[model samples]
Target: MAEAEAGREGGESTLTVLVALGANAAIGVLKLIAGLLTGSAAMLAEAAHSAADTATEGLLLTALRRSSRAADRRHPFGYGKERFFWALIAAVSIFVSGAVFAIYEGIRTIVGEEAEQTAVLVAYVVLAISFVLEGISWTQAVRQLRREAAADELSPMEWLRRTDDPTVKTVFFEDSAALIGLLLAFAGVGLHQLTGSALYDGLASLLIGVLLTGVAYVLGRTNKGLLIGRQADPRLVRALRDDLGARPEVDAVVDLLTMMLGTDQVLLCARLDFDDALGAADLERTCVAIDADLRERFPDLAEIFLEPVPRSDPTMRERVLSRYGESTGLGRPTP
Candidate 1:
């Protein structure tokens, strides 16, 4: 987080997110007041959820700050993955504090609370205002995420799946859920007010909890995978192979393997088949070419392992033949 205080800077990304976080905090307090005054269980649950989100946003910003740190002897790859780790923690907190708490409160009301409806107009008014504020924050987050994903050449949903930074992705999804949930809350509160039925509000809260829990689970799995290291995407592997094969020194890509060390970092162990006549000198040049191409395509790679084998080597040839097959000439014989 100290690095964020240093010279590293992005255009209003920190400021905007921080402001939005503050807004959620303020809105949460207001909703709490409104809930207590009207005895609306749904409003109280919404207040808790919003407050939890506010805390999460603050955590995300802090992670972003930490992730901007420069590489050093301690962490040679820099602190980029720190964001993912911290965000995973935040996601778990969302489930425990926001979703679980809301669910418990909702169940209690469903079983025991009478359908008390006092000053329906006031509840509607407060909810409408909260909706606008939450909507604005959600829209802003989405717009920013959309632009970032587009720059990476990915669809919004696909971008979420591929994104290395969990802080940004988590905030985007959470805000989206919150936006939809607010609408649900409005509908539930309206119905409860109209019909004197506590079921509507409690049910809405339950659904909102479920939505948060699901998002939390997804975010947790994704971040956990990243933290433990995952394989580079298959499509990217194919692209790397093709690029290496295009080099004159590399006769063929015999075997290719990649492991992710961090978000954009990769460790590749590749076996390239070289011509039998090529000596160690030529083979080394091929290795250099592969390294160059990999760096050109993905500069963040942490390590590369290139093993050069003779094209005529039986092991290499057999493997290639198994995949691509030999001419055989069995279909047509020379007379």
Candidate 2:
């Protein structure tokens, strides 16, 4: 079941990335041609932005593939976090290729180093087409995001931050930035034509650069935090405790720890204090039953360890009792 879910998510990410890649690649080519023919600085900036987006999407696609590898002896936790590494690289590339270059071009045009286009029809046409294509890609990303968010019962912003899947998040932000960049390009070109000055065009380029820079920072930060060993969501933790505590043999839950191993996988370690009435043989059987039940409940839990400890130790028992309160729905005495 976990494998099926991962496959579905993989398919979704692949489709989203491919659509964005095709649109950006085509838009980049058109913008480059239009920029060259019309000598419009804003058009050139838009061309560079589209080219960078195409490259970033390719990088994200690679991340999705390489990170999906099954666990081996060398990587017991699997290659899930490789998605974060590649995403970080994409963010850095955007800053260098998209933000820095656009800003430079804007500054140069402002100083009259590049000629402004007096005939801007080609720029306008290219911008309009790019807007429509980018909008389509952005729409697809948002739809996928909304579906995932709904499943988790979270707002879009909350889901984006806590989601183990990084591909959709990256694409959503990139497409959003692309749309903004297109608008900036349009404004820059329009102002240059209206006021008979290239300064507005240059300023527009700077604004796009600022926008890309902000997007890159956010993407990088999100990936970095995930790569550094983020824990599984608290909701999952609470659910695990509630389900285990409901068992008649479970007296109390001592400690529970969980880590996200991959987009669709988690590792859980739990220390459980069973009722004192059970003998050694019954304890062993109970442990096995608990393990089976937990795995059944959470297919995404790739690994689980449940340690049965005697409740004779007062210090440890008291600590466990204090930690799990009534609010967790785990404090009720088992029937």
Candidate 3:
């Protein structure tokens, strides 16, 4: 049952990434051809950025596939770390290919003599078409985001921080970059057309590069945090605690530690002190009951490690009995 669900999820993410990949690839080629013919530095920079995004999306797709591999003798916990590792690579590509390359090309154009466009009409048409396509990609990204956001009852930004899925994260970043890059392209081309100065186009490219760099830095930090086994979610933690507290066998949830191993899968470790206990057999039965309860509560909970023990030593038990009305985990007998 779990394996079937996992396959469905993997298929969904792959589909999303592929849509983003196809859009970026088409845009990059069009922009590159347009930029070269019209001598628009801004368009050239945009082309470079789109191409970088295309490569990053491809890497993310690869990561998603490898991360879903089944656990075996080599690795007991499964290959979930592949997601974070490749996301890191995507972040680096944004910095080097998109940011650095664009900045360098922009500077080169700025330093050279200002050149007039031989075909202003050609540049305008390309930018207009590019803008429309970029808008299409952006819309798809938002649609995917809204669906995920609805589940958490959160705004777009709120969802970004909370969502652990790589496809949603990658598509959001790429589409955002495309929209902003389109604006920069317009500004650069419009300014150059207005003043007949190549310098304006170059200046716009430089600014676009700076923006991409900042975004890359943010992505890098986010991916690094995920790779380090960040806690699943604060809300999940609270929910688990509340559910456990409601259970008859569970006295109080002492502490529960959870880490996200994949988008929806988590590893949960709980130290639970039961109420009044009876014999060894009773305790074992309680353990089985507690495990069953958690599985029912959380469908996506993959692995659960539980420790069932008494609340205190003999002296501590006596103290608790005296202070509170009764001791926990083998409390005083009822009258």
lDDT by residue (tens digit), candidate 1, 7-114 = 233434565577569768878887788878877767777787887788888788877778767779998767767877888888887898789877876787789858
lDDT of each: 0.73, 0.84, 0.78
RMSD of each: 5.8, 3.1, 5.5
Q: Candidates ranked by lDDT, best first?
A: 2, 3, 1
At residue 55, candidate 1 shows an lDDT of 80
Per-candidate TM-score against the hidden true structure: 0.82, 0.89, 0.87
The runs of at least 3 residues in candidate 3 whose Cα sits more than 4 Å from the true structure, single-residue gaps closed, are 1-9, 309-335
Candidate 2: Cα lDDT at 74: 98
Weakest ten-residue segment in model 1 by summed lDDT: 326-335
Q: Rank the candidates by TM-score, best first.
A: 2, 3, 1
After TM-score superposition, what is the CA distance of residue 263 in candidate 3 from its true location, in Å?
Answer: 0.7
Q: Return whichever of 2 and 3 wins on lDDT.
A: 2
Model 2 lDDT tens row, 176-275: 9988888888998888888878898999888888998998999989888778867789899988878887778898776777877767678998877788
Candidate 3 lDDT over residue span 1-114, tens digit each: 756866776776777778778888988898888888888888889888888889988998889988888888997877887888898899899888888878987998899877
Backbone clashes for every candidate come to: 0, 0, 1
Which parts of model 2 are misplaced by more than 4 Å? 112-114, 309-335
For model 2, give the 10-residue run with minimal summed lDDT: 326-335
The CA lDDT at 41 in model 1 is: 69
